[model samples]
Target chain A: MTSETPIIVLVRPQLGENIGKCARAMLNFGLTELRMVAPRDGWPNPSAGPAAAGADSVLDQAKIYDTTAEAVADCSHVYATTVRLREDTKRVVTPEEAATEVFNQAGRSAFLFGREASGLDVQDVAMANAILTVPINPEFGSLNLAQAVILCAYEWSKTQSLSQPTLTEQLPPAPQQDLDGLIGHLEAMLEPKGYFLPDSRADATRRTLRNVLTKPGWNHLEVRTLRGVLSTLAKRDRK
Target chain B: MTSETPIIVLVRPQLGENIGKCARAMLNFGLTELRMVAPRDGWPNPSAGPAAAGADSVLDQAKIYDTTAEAVADCSHVYATTVRLREDTKRVVTPEEAATEVFNQAGRSAFLFGREASGLDVQDVAMANAILTVPINPEFGSLNLAQAVILCAYEWSKTQSLSQPTLTEQLPPAPQQDLDGLIGHLEAMLEPKGYFLPDSRADATRRTLRNVLTKPGWNHLEVRTLRGVLSTLAKRDRK
Candidate 1:
């Protein structure tokens, strides 16, 4: 299924730094479209560049609108993000649920976020088809703008075919023969040191040692390096 | 299932602000215990407070250790967070998978985050039971300190019963009677306008209309509001 990314609309955001940070958060998850509804400090705020770190593309293509309605006018689905009490009745869904709906539906979706101090006005929320809220600490619901943006963006990204940051090709496990050789070398050294004492328990002790060594699923390179360490220790004992 | 919240250990972290932000990220998902290993600028850095915003309790109780081993000495399980190439053999798992394992195992777990620039070294990874990595963009794997902390914390929190930020007791769906009232009200207005034009397919058309209205699963207040809106539209037609 093609991923339907929603346009992020920041309604009257106060700081350029926060805008930049929000841009960084969006690009981190592959969301590009940004719409601003009457920014307090105005668009192209000089302070935003440095804060964005390197997400210049998001900041570069950010579109500004006069009002929330105009910003989301073209959207088939609009989710207003707010934590305050609403006077109008609207369906409330968590970020995860909203993201699922966004991906499932085929249309232009817009997520509307309110100003810094005071969130979206009643009219702004009424314009939205639904409300998206994050599961935050009720006692301290103090999520900043960028934090909120990242939470939503991250959830939506999970539904898409985004590449995992750390899933690179891994080396296969070492051959059993090589592992056994390394185990034998270690056992030979330990036998001289009397590390496995008590003839009655020697077999069980060796079995336990083998289990610990094999648990890591060491690759050939790791096995070689470990054997080298054991050889070095043995040579020191000879000295 | 009981959430075995992992102890976050910062190994040779450079900045106080980043440390504070990490604490904030941890608390955001209900992971509280934080241990710092040899902070460069020393503990209780003034810069951390403002950056942390209001996560004072986490910072106030932050523990400092001389080494990574000391920090995680008491923990039964240790996960090292890193994005670097390792020379050792260790099973690497994604944050989601690691979180699952963490919650399933019945013991104290510690997550170690390395310095901002270099990540965890070989020695640090060797100490860990497993490697925890986030799936990030290969081209730009520049996840800041707080971002990384929050990602793992959020994933782990999902396995727990921590109250969602927006899960205030919602009014159950509007009763079937109320929903029927809403459907009837809308149909009454549509009937006069001959919305069901073809007489033969009028029943099927009405069913389709009902299906659309019920899909949103509107609550009682939402249904009442829609009915009010319909009445207003009808009154305007009369005018």
Candidate 2:
């Protein structure tokens, strides 16, 4: 197992059995860490143990989060498994490509898989740097949650040796928390200017802004510079 | 959806739900042809339809055979999925390599996956030209039948366009029936000469013979030539 292996984050998963299955799939490809965001059923469901099929350790160490933001706070690269047609600006990638990029880049990555039926919502997708979609038969594309997770895990395993220890001196992308702080600062400044006017379209506008901001994958230093710029711009308003 | 997609053959599969899951996995990757040999509960299993998760077309078109030999009789290139540790002479390849070769080679190919619990028997493995092994985590390698099938199907899908139609001129290896016929003929001739002595070791000896014979992948003409030679030698012995 590599240190940079992406963590699997299931957002609002419905069933304990499915969660257990996802863990089994991840372990099969050598992925260990699992995080869940607000599961419908509370953690430590007795049903999960029998379904894990001997991958108990993954479930045992799985960390629970109150929200997706908190789950991926430390993750520098976040990928959303999109189940719906989205016209967002986020770049869509196949599992194979996502694995390659994750291995080559220096960062802690997390792949967010939404609820089994509905998949990620607009807010959840807005947090991702890229959309990961599996190319399936257009006629019959019915990959279950575990199946989808396994494919991504398998692809990631294939590129396990791709990252060299000193391949890049550049810092990895800033963690999701830092990026959120930058976005939050910008939103606060823009909110008073009527940039998000019309309550009906405010959600869409915010999502678009997030899509654009997250696309840059700014490093920690760049994010700090941008924050400083925002603070300076805000200071002029007080003056 | 290429015509040369390898057929998935399950030999002596035990469960109906697993068969259905396999169908779903195969369809997700554009593989529609499914063959089964000696399913424990018999064909048209009632339980399979529900588990297919709307991949009914795949299950609806599945073909059944009484034996592994017949299941792959029309297939030109036979690949056996070995689940156990084997020190056999046959070449073992990863699913990716098998997919590449299958696409490049001009032949109807078949992949033989063994029973859910006990993978293909020695005799079944001997029937194959090569072995297919998934490179999984050594410690926690718990890939169920559907998981294994999906990984293979996923890998096979990756090389869908790798084969250009006009690349090979040499005829594809003769359909498996031709090879089996040749083996049958040679076996009959050698049976009277005490070639397979010691009843306890006969099965191993036969497997060795099959492994040697299948390795060559002789085309129709080559098989025909060998058959004629066997008949001629038999005639001389009778005289």
Candidate 3:
């Protein structure tokens, strides 16, 4: 359930830049499998490298096929992405629902996306086991190829233990003793500025200030930075 | 809970195509409000129109600001979307967690995205009430501007009742009788084809066939189409 990544198939994609962007989106979520069926201008377009930003590995390994059927022939589950009216009676599911199914199902799965100007034709839709649609505004249902790929990729990524940029290894919170030192330093700087002016309410104001400062659970680096900022302000007054 | 949409503020976004693509992503998830803080190429960029596809309204109504502070001046809650190290100790939440908070908490919320190359500076992050980070591949956390925007917008839209392109006014499942007829038609076609050649296993095979056909919960149209396919196959042998 955690490691299975869906293969992205672009059906008759028009632009090289879009193909590169799709690769970028796929790599963002840890997906690397990409299949292209009949790219209009052919493969290895020079414009793709810069557009991909840095996801060139996905582009390098992308497989090309002559038709949609061949692209997804190995997949046990196939999902076609489109907003156009599907004449066939294929079961349609939102990207969220489709992602859940993809995670639960065994074997490789493929997500098919159509061309830029026009979507998958009737024959393409018929080949898919299901239709994956994003809930979009009716007035403006224009989703670019990368956007569509990303919506599905992001949803699928949620089911996996992908590392979040913020969740990566970070500095531990400063110990309570260090935090107290930081609070004391700030209070000392504010005391001479009349920040605790009224004696009657001074105790309560100090407590409130302490609560605000402690709420963030500042790591040592943050505490050090704030102390530096206070020292700079103090030095300005001396000048 | 459904109608609340977050304001997307791009602080110092470099490219017009990226801005246009951001609008396209926002509209795909029913988000309309977009604000820009000093885009490098300038507002009403000539290149944006083509990149946006048909999401012109989102681009048309997009507001511009000279600074991040003024862009989120009216927002009660502001979230800074960044992967950089912040000197300030702000509470960080993943996009999934942030989307839940945005739906539950009342008041207008804003998400600030930084430039493509450098990301949000310390000043921009300091203004935000909290930090929002997408769980991405750590080795390559290079999510472009539009990819970041879509990740947040898609997560937020999951909390709303935005009409899914597939979930809108679908036909109900066909009656059991209709499905039974479809199964019978296929069985009849298979009868003469030696599909059930071994008499001893014919009964078990029929039951297995029924189980596979009934799993999809096909609507009337699908049943009719399957039956049509069966009839065509039967006629093919006659011709």
Candidate 1 residue-wise lDDT at A52: 90
Ranking by DockQ: 3, 2, 1
TM-score to true structure, per model: 0.76, 0.81, 0.75
Please provide, for model 3 over B1-239, each residue's C-alpha lDDT reduced to its tens digit, 9 standing for 90 to 100.
Answer: 34468999999999898888898888877888999999998888988878887888899999999999899999988999986545668898888888888898888899999998889988999899999988777776778788788888888887876465464465667899998998787666566555554899889778766755565466776567556444433332211
* Native contacts present in each candidate (fraction): 0.16, 0.34, 0.45
Model 2, runs deviating above 4 Å: A1-3, A83-85, A161-239, B1-3, B161-166, B237-239
Worst 10 residues of 2 chain A by lDDT: A161-170
Q: Quote the TM-score that chain A achieves in each candidate.
A: 0.89, 0.66, 0.65
Clashing pairs in model 1, backbone N/Cα/C closer than 3 A: A135-B164, A135-B165, A136-B165, A164-B135, A164-B136, A165-B135, A165-B136
lDDT of every predicted structure (CA atoms): 0.75, 0.82, 0.77
Per-residue lDDT for B109-141 in model 1, tens only? 788899998888665665666678766555555
The CA lDDT at A216 in model 1 is: 47
**Candidate 2 lDDT, A42-141, residue by residue in tens:** 9987878787899999999999999999999999999999745589899999999999988888879999999999899889999999999988887888
- Using lDDT as the yardstick, the better of models 2 and 3 is 2
The 10 consecutive residues of candidate 3 chain B with the worst lDDT sum are: B230-239
lDDT of 1 by residue, A1-239 (tens): 67578999999999999899999888887788999999998878998989898988889999999988899989999999986545557899888889899999988999999988898888888889998977666555667788788878887877777656455466777899989998898777666555566888889778766755565466676677556545543332111
Report residue A42 deviation for candidate 3 (angstroms).
1.8
Interface RMSD in Å per candidate, to 1 decimal? 33.6, 34.1, 33.8
- Name the top TM-score candidate: 2
Question: What is the C-alpha RMSD, rounded to one decimal, of candidate 3?
Answer: 27.9
